[model samples]
Target: MRPLIGLDQVSVAFPGTLALDRVSLQVFPGDVLAVIGANGSGKTTLLTTLTGLRAPTGGTVVDADGPVRLRGPADALTRGVALVPQEPQLATSLPVWENLLIGHGGLRGAAPGRAARARARALVAEALPHVDPGTPAGQLRKADRAIVALLRAQSSRPKVLALDEPTAVLGDRGVEIVAEATSRLRAEGGAVVLVSHRLRDIVRLATRVAVLVDGRLVHDAPIGEVSVEELVETMAAGRPASAQVTARVTGERPSGGSAVPRAREHRLSVEVLAVRGLREHGLSVDELTVRAGEIVGLAGLAGSGRSRLCRLVAGASGGSAPVTFLGGPLPSDTRASRRAGIAYLPEDRANESVFAGLTVARNLEIADVVPAGLGTLFGPRPDRSRTARTISEFGIKTASHQTEITALSGGNQQRAVLARVLAHQPRLLVADEPTQGVDRTGRAAIHTMIRRFAESGGAVLVVSSEFEELQELADSLHVIRDGRVVARRPPDCEYRELVALATGARDEKEAEQ
Candidate 1:
C-alpha cells in the first residue's frame, strides 16, 4: 500500500542545533507506527513537521496526496491531521463539554441542547469515563484533563492521529485506554503515529517501529523483530557488554561500611509538614515514618496515590498537612520543610518539576538562591564553589555549568537536578518515580545516590510504578491501595507477592481475614 504519511529527507533546524537531519520515514494506511527515540532526538520535531507546525529546512512531509506546508497548529488540524501534543494545553475555565467542543472549531451546539448534551456525554463515555462532562476542566485532575484532550481529538475522527507521549500522565488503566483507542483508530483505516519512550507500549501496539538518534533514522523494522534492550543499545550507539558495569562502578561512592558504600543508606525516617487528611485517590496515611538508615519503598499501580503521597511529603502541594520533623511539627510550607532538611525528587519532570530554560548551574542553585539568613532582603553569603565542585563530584558531564539544562542528555539533566537537591544534604529524601525515562546507566547512578543517602542515617521514601526498581533498591516495601497502606514487607519481599498486592490479587489467607 502507498504510505498514507511520508517524510522524504526531512530536516528541521533551530538556532543552535539541527533538530531533524535528512531523516526519512513513512506510515501505511491503518498502520500503528511508533516513533521511538531518546529525549531531544527530534521525535517532536518530526511530528510537528508532519502536522505542519514546523516547516522543513529541506525535503518534504507529504500526506500521500500532497505536501503539508508549515503553518500553525490550527492549519494542521484543518488538514485532517490532529496532534495530541505532549503537553495538551486546555482551557481550564471552560466546562469539559466546552473544552471538547472548543477543539472542534468551537462549540457549535449549545450546552443545554439535547443533542449537544448527548453528544458530549457520548464523547466522555467513549474516551474518558472518569471525567464529568458538566464539570469545569480546571477542576479535573491533570491526567483527566489529558484524557479530555484525547477525546476531543477522537471526536474529530480525523484521517491521521498523532499522539506525543499520550501515556505520560496516565495510570495503568489509562495507558490501556490509549492503547485501545489507537488500535480502534487503525481498524477504521486511520493512520497513527505514536511517539513514546516506553518500550513495552511500543512493542505491544506498534505494527512498525522507527528508532531515531541524534536526528537520524537508525532503525526501522517490524515490532516483532526488535527487543527493548536491543533498541536501548542502538540508541546508545552500541551494545557494549560492560556499559552498565562501568556506570555502576563509577557511580559507586566508596565502602565506609555498607555493601554499597557511597550508596546513601537511610532507614525509614519521617519528615512531616502541614498536611491534613492528605487525600487524593483514597488512601489515608496518618502519622507515617521510617527509621533512618532504612530503605522504604512504596509500591502501587498508578492511581494508587503513590505519586501524590510523595508530593505531599516533599511539600509540593499547597494545602497544609501537619508534618513533624524529629519530634517537633514542621512549618506548614515547603520552605520550612526544606529548612527541616527535607528534599524531594518529583515524578513528572516535564511538568511538575524542571525549570527547562534555566542553565544547569541555575537549576541546581534554585534551592540555595537565598539561603536562609543570608539577608532578609537577600544578600550573598557563602561561596557556592564547593557546591559546584560537588556537582562535578556527582559526575555530571556538561560543556559548562552555564550549559542550558535542556541541552543535557536525560540522564545528565536528572543528575544535575539531583545534585541541586543533594547540595543541601537533606536528612530525608522523597523520590517519586526517580528513574522514569532515564537510561540503564542513569538508573544505576540514581540508585547509587539514593543508597548513599540512606547510609548516612538519612531517611527515604521511594515511590515507584516499576516493581523491579523497588525490588532492587528498597529494604522494606509498603503496598498502597486506594489511598491506604494495606501491607508492609521486608526488603526481601517476594516479587509475586508484591505484584499480587499491587494488582489487588488475593488468596485464601486474605479471604479468611
Candidate 2:
C-alpha cells in the first residue's frame, strides 16, 4: 500500500544544531507509527517536518498523490493531516460539543447546525462515551479533555493524526483512552504517528516503531520484531554524555520575619507557607502545608482548582490571606514572591514562564533583573559567571548561552526555567506540571532537581495532572476534587488511588456523585 504521507530525506537546522539530518519516514494507511528518542534527539523536529508545522531545511515531503509543496499546518490539515500538540489549548469556556466544531482542534467556521451537532455527538459516543457533550471544555477531567481533542480531530477524519507526547502526562486510564482512540482510527483505515518516550505506549499501540538518534532514523521495524530491551538500548546509545552537576543549592533559610498572617492562626512551625482556609474563585483549601525539608504535591483532574490554588499561593493578587510564609503573610505579587524567597513555575510555561525571544543566559538571569525592573536588552549585562554556573548546574543543553530558548527542546527549556527560578534562591518552589512535555530522560533530570532542592531545606508544592508523577515526587500527596482537599496520602500512594479520589471514580456510588 502507498504511504498516506512521508518525509523524503528531510533536514531541519537551527543555527548551530541539525535538528533533523536527512531523516526519511513514512506513514501508511492504517499505520500506528511510534517514534521514540531521548531528550533533544530531534523527535519534535521530525514530527513538525512531517506535519508542515516547520518547513524542512532540506529534502521534500511526499504524499501518495505527489510531492506536497506548501509548508504550513493549515495546508496539511486541509489535506487531511493534523498534528495534535502535547498540550492542545481547547476553548475551555465553550462546551466540548461547540469546541469540536470550532477552534484549533476542529474545523474553524464549521457551522454548529443540527447536522454538525449530530456528527459531534456521534464522535463523542464512539470515542468517549462517558463524557457529556455539553460539558465545558474546562470542566471535564484532564483525560476527557484529551479524548475530546481526539474526537474533534476525528471529526475531520484526517488521513493521518500526528500526536506529540499525548500520554506523557497521563495515567493508565488516560493512556487507555488514547490507545482505544488509536485502535478505532486504525480500524477505520486512518494512520497515526505517535511521538512519545513511554515504552509502554509504543508496545501497546504502535504497528511499527521508528527510533531517531541525533536526527537520523537509526531503527525502524515491525512491532512484533523488536523487544523492549533492544528499543531502550537503541535510544540510549544516542543520548549525549550525561549532563554534569557542578554545585548544590544553599539550603540555609533566610532570617525569620516578624510579620504574621491576621487571616488565621497557625500552630505548626512553618517551613513553607501554611494555608488555613483558602476560598477563592470556586476553590476551597481547608489546610495545606510543606515543611522546610519536604515536598508536597497536589493531584487533580482539569478544572479541579489545582492551578488556581497554586496561583494564589505563588502571590498572584486575589484571595484571602490564607497563607503564612516564613512568619509573614504570603507575598501578594510576583516580584514580592521572588523577593520573599519563593519561586513559582507556572503551568503555561510557553506563554508565562519562559521568554522565548531571549537567550538561555538571558532567560536564566532575568528572574533577578526583572524583579528590579530592568529590560533584558538594556539591563546591565547578566552576571556572566553566574549564568555559566546556572547552565551547568541545571543541565541546560544549548549550543551557546546566547542561543534563543526556543531553539532548544522542551526539556531543555523547562530546565532553564527551573534554573532561573533557583537563581532567586527561593525558600519555597511552586511547580505546576513541572515535567509535562519532557521525555523520560528530561523527567528524571527534573525529578532530581526537585528532590535536591527539597533536600536543601527548600519547601516545595507541586501540581501535576500525572498521578504517577505526584506519587513519585511528593512526600505527602493531596487529592483535590471540586476544589476541596479530599484526601492526603504518603508518597507511596498508588496512581489508581489518586485517580479515583481526584476523578470521583472510586466506586459506582462515588462515581455517581
Candidate 3:
C-alpha cells in the first residue's frame, strides 16, 4: 500500500529542548504502529505534529498524496486524522449523543433529522455495542470515555486514527475492547497509531513498534522481532540516570529476625473522617482511613466517585466534609487541608498542577514555600540550590532550573510535578491518577517516591481508575463504585477480585442503586 502519511527530516525545537530531531517515518493503510519512548522522548509532540496541531521547525510532513500546509486539528480531521488526547475532555452536561456528534462537527452543523439520528445510532452500534446511546457521556466510566472517543473519531471514517494512551484508564476487559476495536479498524483498512506505556496493548495491536529516545527515533522494527523486556530496557536507557535509578536496589534488605520484627511495626493508622451519609451522584462512603506508611489504593470504574473522594479529602470539592487527617477532621477548605500536610497530585496535570509560564524552580517551590537558611521570604528568596537539587533528585530533565515548564515533555512535566509535591514532604499524600501521562521510567520513579513516602511514616491515599495501577501500588486496595467504597482488600488483591469489585459484579441491585 502507498504511504498514508510520511514525515521527512522533521524537527521541533522549544526554548530549551528539541522535542523531535530530524525524524522520518511512514504510516500505511491498515497499520497499527505502537510508538514507545521514555517520558521526555517526544511521543506526544510527534503526534501533535502529525495531526497539524504543531508545525515542525524543520523538514516536512506529507499526507496521503503530497506535502500540505498543516493547519490545525480540524484541518487534520477533515484530511482523515483524529487524536484522542492523553486526558480526553468531554462536556459534562452533554449526552452521549451530543458528545459523539461533537466529534462529527458540533451539534448545530452535524447531520440533522431522522437520517442523522439513524446514522448516529448506527455509528454507536458499530463502535460501542455495549454503551447506552441515550446516557450522558459524563456519566460513563473513564474506559467508556475512551471507547466513546474512539467511536466519535471513527464515526468520521478517517483514514488514520491516533489514539494516545487509549487503555491507560481501562481495566483488563476495557483493554480487550480496545484491542478488538483496533482489529476491526485494521480490517476496515484504516491505519491506527497507538501511543501507550502498557505493553499488553502494543503486543496485541501493533504490527510494528518504534521507540524514541530523547527526541531521536531509536528503534523501529517489526513487533515479532522484539520482546517486552528489551523494549523496556531501551526506553529506560533513554531516560536520564535519576529516573532509571530511582527504583534502584529493591529487595536488598538485611535478612534476619530484625527484618521480621520490622513487619509488625509497619502497620498504618488511618484517622477517622466524618463518614456519615455522604452522597454525590450515587457514590457514598460509610467510613475510610489513611494510615501513615501505608499505600491505600482506590479502584473503580470512571465516575465511580474515586476522583471525587480524592477531591473531598484534598478540600478542593464542594461537598459535605467529615474527612480528617492526623486524628483531626480535615477542614472544609483547601488551605486547611494543605496546612495539615496533605498534598494532592491531580489526574489532569496540565490543568490542575504546575503554573506553566513560571520557572521550574519556582514551580517546584509552590507546594511548600519554606525558607531553607534565613527562614525569611525576603532574605535570599527561597534557595535556588535546594530547588535544583530537588529537581535532580526527582529525575526531572530540564535545561536548567530557570527553564520554562511548558517547554518540557509531558513526562518531564509530570516529573517536575512529582518533585514539587515530594519536596514538601507532606504527612499525607493524596495522588489522583499520578502516572496518567508518564512513561515507564517516570512511572517507576513515581512508584519509588510513593513507596519511600510510605516507608518514611507518611500516609498515601491514591485514587486510580486504572485497576492495574491500583494493584501494583496500593499496600491495601478499596473499590469505589456508584460513589461509595463497595469493598476493600489486602494490597495483593487478586486481579479478578479487584475487577469484580470495580464493576460491582458481586453487589446486589440494592447496593448499586
Candidate 4:
C-alpha cells in the first residue's frame, strides 16, 4: 500500500538540542503506527514536524500525491492532516461548544447558519457525552478539556490523524473513546500516528511500532514482533538488547504474620497530616491521613478528582475540609499551608509551578522569600550558596543558576520545580503528576528524590494517572472513582486489578476477594 505520508531523512534541531536526526518513517492508510521513546527523545518533535508546527531543518515530507512543504498548521489542516496535542489547547475562556467549533468555522468568523451550528453541537454531544458543550472550557476538569480537544480533532475528519499521548491523562472510558475513534478512522482507510508511554495502549492500538532513542530511530518492527519487555529494555538502555531479563521485587511486602508487625508500626507512627470533611471541585473525601515517613498514592482516571483532592489538601483550592498537620489545626489557605510545612507541586508545572522568565536561583528563592510591598525598600534576595547546594542535590542540569528556567528541557524544568518546592524542607509533600512527561532517567531521579524525602521522616502524597508509576513508587495506593476513594491496595496489586478498581469495574470488596 502507498503511504499516505512519509518523512524522508528528516532532521530537526533547536539551539543546543538536536531533537530529531535523520529520522525517516511512513504512515499508510489504515496503519496505526505507534511511536515509543523516552522523555526528550523527539516523539513530540516528530509529531510537530508532521503537523507543520515545526518544519524540518532537512529532508522532505512527501504525501502519496506528491512532495509537500507545510507552511503552518493551517496548511497541514487544509491538506486533511490533524494533530491532537499532548496538552489540551482549548480556549479556556470560551464555552465548550465554541471551542469545539473553533477550527470548523461553525460559531466564529463567517458564522455558519443555525442548522450548521446545531449540527456541530449535536456532533460534539454525540461524540463526548460526558462534556457539557455549554460549560466554559476552563471550568471543566483537565480530562474533560482533553476530551474536547480530541472531539474537535476527530470532528475535522482528517485523512491523517496524529495523537500525542492521547491516553496519558484519560481513564478507561477515555481510552475506549480514543480506541473507537482509531478503529473508525482505520475502517475508513485513514491513517494514525500515536505517541505514548503506556505500553498497554501501544499493544492494543498499534499494528507497527517504532523505537526512538537520543533523537535517532533505533528499531522499527511489527507490533507482534516486539514485546512490552523488549520495548522497556530498548528504551531504558537506549539500544536493542538480547540479555535475559531478571525479576525484581514487585514493591510488595510479604503477607500474613510477617506483614503484621510492619503494618502495626506504620499505624503507630505520628500522623503528619489529616483531613476531614474535604469537598471541592465535585470531589469529596470524608477522612484521609498520611503518617510520617510514608508515601501514599492516589490513583484514578483523569477527572476522577485525584488532582483536585491534592489541591484541596494543599490549600490551593477553596474547600470546607477540616485539615490538621502535626496534630494541630491547619488553616485553609496557601500561606498557612506553606507556613505549616506543606509543599505542593502542581500538575501544570509549565505555567503554575515555574516562572519561565525568572532565573533558576530566583525561582528557588521564591519558596522561602515573599515579595515585599511598595513601602519596602528592597525585596528578599536568593541565598546563592543555598541555591547552589539545591541545584546539586536535585540533579538539575543548567548552565548556571542565573539561567532562565524556560531554557531547560521539560525534565530539567520539572526538576527545578521540585528543587524549589523541596528547598523549604516541608513536613508534608503533595506532588501531582510529578513524572508525567519525564524520561526514564528523569523519572528515576524524581522517584529517588521522593523516596529520600519520605525516608527523611516526611509524609508524601502523590496523584498520578500511570498505574505502574503508583505501583512502583507508592507503598500504598488508593483507587478513586467519581470523586471518592473506592479501593485501597498494596503496591503489589495487579496492574489490571488496579485499573478495574479505579474504573469501578470491580468494587473494593470484589477486588479484595
lDDT of 4: 0.77
Provide the TM-score for each candidate, comma-separated: 0.59, 0.57, 0.58, 0.64
Worst 10 residues of 4 by lDDT: 239-248
Q: What clash pairs does model 2 have? A: none
Which residue runs of candidate 1 sit more than 4 Å off their true CA positions? 12-19, 38-41, 53-59, 106-118, 125-131, 168-176, 224-241, 244-313, 318-332, 344-425, 428-513
Better of 1 and 4 by TM-score: 4
Root-mean-square deviation (CA) per prediction: 8.3, 11.2, 10.0, 7.8
Candidate 3 error regions (>4 Å): 103-110, 125-132, 238-324, 327-336, 343-513
lDDT of each: 0.70, 0.75, 0.71, 0.77
Task: Report the C-alpha lDDT of model 4 over 345-419, residue by residue, as the tens digit.
Answer: 999998799897898888888876532323566766667998899999899999999999888877888998888
User: 1-513 in candidate 2: lDDT tens per residue?
Assistant: 888899999899985568889988889988999987654578888888888889998989999986887569878888888887777668999887877787433455545678878888777766667778777889987667777777777777788999887874454565787777788788888899998765665788899999887788899889889977677667656322211110111222212311211111222355677888777656677788887877788977655678878888888754257778886788768787788788899999899988988888888877767566644566656689989988998898889999999999899999999988977678999998998788767877888888878766788999886555565556678877666677777655444455456544442244331
Q: Name the top lDDT candidate.
A: 4
What are the runs in model 2 whose C-alpha is more than 4 Å off? 103-113, 125-131, 239-336, 344-513
lDDT, residue 153, model 4: 86
TM-score of 1: 0.59
